[model samples]
Target: MAVYEKVKRAIEQMVGDKSSEFKVCVEDTRGTLGGILIKIEDVKTQEISAFRINEGDEGEAEHMTMYSVDTMLQRRKAEGIARLEEIERVLGIKFEKWQREYILSRGLGYPIGGRRTGRTLAHQVKTLMKSKDDIIIYPNQRWTYLDEPERMRNSERYAQGYVKKLRELSEKLRNHGINVPRVIEVDDPQAEFLTKRMNLPARRGDGMR
Candidate 1:
C-alpha cells in the first residue's frame, strides 16, 4: 500500500468515530511551505473525509508535521531562554546553567519561583536529592550534603545561598525577554504591599518577554 494511505489509515483509526462529522483528505504527494498539508473538516453529503498526502514515499506529510511540531517546541524553549535573559537584564542578576535546568526540568509551569509548600527550598532540595540518587547539583550551584543532624545549621547556609541565587536568577531571566513580573523595589518593601503589588502575571503565551 502507499505510504500516505498507511498513515492516513492509521490516523483515522486513532481518531476513530470521533471524526464522523468531519472529512479527512490524504494526497498521494503533499508538500507544504512549513509543514504537512493535512486538513480535517466536514464533507458534503453527510460524509466525513480524512485526507493526507505524501510528498514522497518518505511520508513527507507526517515527517513535515513532526518537524513543524518539533520546531514550534524549540522556538518556545528559545523564547523562554530569551525571557530569562530579559529578566536578568532588568533585575541585575545572573542564573547558573544548572539552576535554569532545574527549573525547566521540573515542568513546574511558567512564572517559576521558589517552592512554596510550607517546606523551605533547602528542605525540598534535600528531599529531592535523597529520593533521586542520580541527581547531582552542579558546581556553580551550591548544594547541601546533609548526613548528620548536627550539621543542619551549616547545611542550611547552602539553602540560603540557593534562595538568594534563585531570586537573582529569576530576575535575570525576566530581563532576558521572558515576561516576568515587573520588579519593583529590590530592597525591603512593606510586608502588606509585597504580595498585592507584585501579583501581576509574569509568563507570556510563548514564554516571551
Candidate 2:
C-alpha cells in the first residue's frame, strides 16, 4: 500500500462513520527535505478543514539520543556562554559570565508598552471584528488563565491589566469618534482576588513570595 493511502485509511478509521461525507487528501512533496501533506475536509458543510503536513523524518525517533546529566549540563552551559558572547559582540556591552542577578519578570502577557508588535490595539480590534475565517490563530495569546492566591499576586495583576487594556481601547475608540462604554465594571477593584491553593503550579522560579 502507498504511504498516502495508509494515512488516509488510518484517518478514516479514526473518524469511523462520520467521515462518510468527508475527504482526506494526501500529497507527497518533493525537494531536498521530502514530506507528505495531509488535508481533511467535510464535503457537505465545508465548515472546518484542519490540515497538517509532515517534514522529512531523518531517522527512527524511538532511538533518539539521551545524553547523560553531566554532559547535558556542560552542553547547556557552553550554549549559554556562546549566546552571552554574541550579545556582547553585537551591543559592545560586557557581561561577566560568573556574575548573575535576579530581576522580577513582569513580561508575562502582553508586550512591554505594546511597542513590540507595532500593531496598535485599535488595529487589532478592527482586524478581529472584521475577520470571518473559521479558524483564527492567536500568536502570543493565551486562552486559559490560571488565577492564583492573593499572596501569589500574578493572578489579580492580570485582571487589573485587563481592565487597563479595556480602558485604553475605549479611549482609543473615543479618539476616533467611536463611542464605546464609558465605564468598565468589575468586582472588587482594589482587593486581592483570591483562588484556591490547590491550583498552584509546581514551579520553583524565584520562590513565590
Candidate 3:
C-alpha cells in the first residue's frame, strides 16, 4: 500500500467514530529530494495538526501508530494555543480574526529580498522594533560619490543630516515604547576619502584647451 494511504487509514482508525470531524491532506514539497506534509484538521473546532514525512528510509508503520499520531496532534494543539495567546497579548486580538481583518484591509506587498539596501532601511527598523533587543542599526554600503569632488562634499553634509533624522526617529520610536540604538557618526575610510576629495582642486578646463 502507498504510504499516504496507510497514514490516512491509521488516522481514520485513531479518530474512530469522530473521524468525520477531521480532514486529512497531503502536500508535496517540490524539489530534487521530494518531501510531503500531512495535515489533519478538526473541521468543527477549526484546529489544524500537521507533520512532515520526508523522503527517506523509515518504518512508516511506527509513525502511523495510534499513540504516535495522537501525541503529535496533542503537541500541535498545545503549540497553537500558545501562539494564539502570544498574539492576543501583543495585539489584543485573536490571531484568526486579526488575520482575516488584516488580509481584507491591505494589499499584500511584494516579497522582501535577502539583500539589504538604503531603500529597505525603514522596513529593517520596523523588524528590529518587533524584537526584544535593546537596539540594532545595520548600515549597508556607503554612498558612492563616483569621483565627483563637489558631490563628495555634499555627501558629507547629507550624512550629517541623515544622522539628525535618525536621532529624531529613534526618539519618536522610544516614545512609543520601541527602544532603538543611538545613531552615531563614526570616522571611516569613506569619510576620509570624501574629505580628501573635497580639498582637491578641480581639473583644468577643457574649454580653454
Native-structure RMSD, model 1: 14.7
lDDT to native, each model: 0.39, 0.35, 0.45
Once fitted onto the true fold, the runs of candidate 3 whose alpha carbons sit more than 4 angstroms away are: 32-34, 56-58, 61-209
The best-first sequence of candidates by lDDT reads 3, 1, 2
Q: How do the residues 1-209 of candidate 3 rate in per-residue lDDT, one tens digit apiece?
A: 36566666776777665566567676676473367666767664466766666654225432744555586567645654554354344444443443323322212221433434222333223322323333322222122211222344457565445445555655655565544444333446465455458994322211111
Roughly what TM-score does model 1 have, to 2 decimal places?
0.33
| Candidate 1: segments with Cα more than 4 A from true spot | 1-36, 39-52, 55-58, 106-178, 181-209
| Per-model tally of clashing residue pairs | 37, 0, 0
What ordering of candidates by TM-score runs from best to worst?
1, 3, 2
Cα RMSD for candidates in order: 14.7, 17.1, 18.1
lDDT for position 179 in model 2: 29
**Global lDDT of model 1:** 0.39
Angstrom error at residue 47, model 1: 30
Using all chains and alpha carbons, the TM-scores for the candidates as numbered come to 0.33, 0.22, 0.29
Writing each residue's lDDT as its tens digit, candidate 1 over 1-209 gives 35545444544554454334334454433334432345544331232333344344445555543443334445546755665565446546565565554433323322343345222332323232222122223232233322222334456566445445544533554455543332122233343255347884321111111
